[model samples]
Target: MSYDNILALNPRIQAHATLRSTVAKKLDKKHWKRNSDKNCFMLSQPNIYCFEFVEKLSHNIFETIH
Candidate 1:
């Protein structure tokens, strides 16, 4: 799956519970740096899930997971 797909799936995974905080908590600074580097990740990317997206997706994913 593409990164967009995975990011899109984030909502399905979150189920609406604030993905930003959840994801951030789950991924420490090191993890973020690694993932970012490996994926050419930019949190500020236009389409990708930035902080706000993560927050929204986390909420969605959390609800769905439960």
Candidate 2:
């Protein structure tokens, strides 16, 4: 398949794969099982910033009944 026909996501796939391969070495050698990512967080420092921000934001959200 040519580049014109392909969506050219290999670079992204490889980037993610490389990041995954280093996760253990980079993040305390723990195998995180429960996880979900929907393009909302980047591989770089998501836990230290993005998720933590969302967590604190959600905590302040006022609960209301429908």
Residue pairs of candidate 2 with colliding backbone atoms: none
Model 2 collision count:
0
Candidate 2: tens digits of C-alpha lDDT, residues 1-66: 887557665544444444445656746434453565455645654467777887777777744321
| Global lDDT of each candidate | 0.67, 0.59
Query: Which candidate number has the best TM-score?
Result: 1
For all predicted structures, in order, the TM-scores are 0.28, 0.27
Worst 10 residues of 2 by lDDT: 11-20
Clash counts for the predictions, in order? 19, 0
Q: Report residue 33 deviation for candidate 2 (angstroms).
A: 35
